[model samples]
Target: MKLWGGLSVLGLVYAALAFGIDQTFKWWMLHVFDIEARQPVALLPVFDLVLAWNKGVSYGWLSGDASQDLLIAMSLAIAAGLWIWLAKATHPMTAAAIGLIIGGALGNALDRAVYGAVADFFSFHIGSFSWYIFNLADVAIVAGVGLLVYESFTEGRAR
Candidate 1:
């Protein structure tokens, strides 16, 4: 419950590591590997790495003709809200979840600022069905949200 405690520091560390790893992978994919010019690289039987620029939100909705400035503003606002939540987090899991959300939001926001869109590279398919392409940041966000949901369901029972 104390500020600057172990949980708080862990949250900060998680945020920094998430952001750093995501950015580094993006840089490697775009600059070092030039993934845009190559075909999808198969990493697994049903997974591949390919470059995709998403100009809008999840699943590419509300992206066409959208303003980059507006998107960036929204992302920043979300990150700020998550940061506030992180500051007041009572549980370590909650703090970690907030950190993941903040890191992912800022990562995508950075993409919007620099490339006018978010760069998605991972692709997954199962026979005929395919999932949307996404990046590490998206993965972190989803995992964080999942943890939060789990916590929500279990918090009251802990008493």
Candidate 2:
């Protein structure tokens, strides 16, 4: 298949995963357990499944007082730009990376649109400090970034 075709397929797949799986999980978390309920399902000693909401960016920055309207607007803009960029991507790996990033952005953007906040349910803790709660969308974004970085380094080596 052509690069454009592959990109389209991958992008749609990513978007579907983000929309279907993430939203379903969010709905369950919100409707079944409620946002404020905290029950630790231990994945490991340092990790737990605990429901939390983030009204702002990563690590809950600007969470308390940030304007929801501004955040949603920015997210929409970013997702659009990213989608266009992903569509234009010529390399399979680049398209995949951008698709993942776009998926993540869309997932969080949907949350903000629907809930006025991002639903973050996974939490990690160690000894004295607890990591900020986050969701699968955040993981996808981080993994996308990691793949992009790896691509950059490996691209240079392959040339």
Candidate 3:
């Protein structure tokens, strides 16, 4: 497949999956589980699945306000720009990174557009300390960023 086509496909797949998974969990959380009911499905002693809703971006910044529309616009702008770049990426890894970032941004953008807040539920904790509740989209963004950094460094080394 062509680079842009591949990236577009990947982005679409991730976006769909992210949307489906996030919405399902949110639906269950709102309907099935009370916000405070912690049913710890411990992946490890230090890591457990607890539901949380975040109003803002990853780690919960700028969550609540009238600025949700603005946030959605900015996210869409960024994702659209990245989609354009994905069309131009010569390397597979580069395309993949762009795909992931585009998908992730689109996922959150949808949330902001529809709900005025991103739904974040997935908390990892270690005793008194814990990470912010986040969703699959956030994971994709972070992974994409790591891949982009790796690609950049490798490309630099090659040149």
Candidate 4:
């Protein structure tokens, strides 16, 4: 019982930290840096900071002129589902992964609610090849998914 409670607390903390960091960075980008009024800022040979507003799912899928509301609703629903999973997670890694995913989803959902889109600022490119623009929340979500995949494979092998 105590262990579960500790896990729950840990998950909540992870979620809050991830969400807060992502939001803070976004606020700094928009307000402090005033990225909206400037061109892309190159940080390295393969990385740059460029503001982009994503109104749809990953890679701008399902994004149209009239789909903002639908996207927000869908994101909220997914976050809710992940929250439930987090509550019931028995493994610490699973809880942490779920927390990361939930935090990221909620952060983006909040952006959709307030700004009508998610603010993406980090761009990675190699000469002519460019990756999708993303933010801290996207990084957390991807890392969490990678952890989950690793756990799935390792658990199966152990059993």
| TM-score of each prediction | 0.91, 0.86, 0.77, 0.92
lDDT values of the candidates? 0.86, 0.77, 0.72, 0.86
Q: How far is candidate 3 from the true structure (C-alpha RMSD, Å)?
A: 3.6
Q: What are the per-model C-alpha RMSD values against the true structure?
A: 2.3, 3.1, 3.6, 2.6
> Candidate 2: worst 10 consecutive residues by lDDT?
1-10
lDDT value for model 1: 0.86
TM match of model 4 to true structure = 0.92
**33-138 in candidate 1: lDDT tens per residue?**
9998885999998999999999998888869546778989988988877776777788999988878877887888899989989999999999999899999999
Count of residue pairs whose backbone atoms collide, per candidate: 0, 0, 2, 0
lDDT of 2 at 145: 82
Model 4: per-residue Cα lDDT at residue 105: 81
**Model 2 vs. true fold: TM:** 0.86
Q: What does candidate 4's lDDT look like per residue over 22-68, in tens digits? A: 99999999999999888599899999999999988889998765788
* Candidate 2 ranges with C-alpha deviation above 4 Å: 1-6, 33-38, 64-66
What is the C-alpha lDDT profile of model 2 across 27-73, one tens digit per residue? 88778866556576678999988776688897767665357778878
Which pairs clash inside model 4? Answer: none
What candidate 3 gets wrong by more than 4 Å, as runs, is 1-43
Ordering by lDDT: 4, 1, 2, 3
lDDT per residue (tens digit) for residues 1-116 in model 3: 23355456665565566556656666676567754466555678777666555566655667677768777888888987887777776777876777677777887777777666
The window of 10 residues in a row where model 4 has the poorest summed lDDT is 1-10
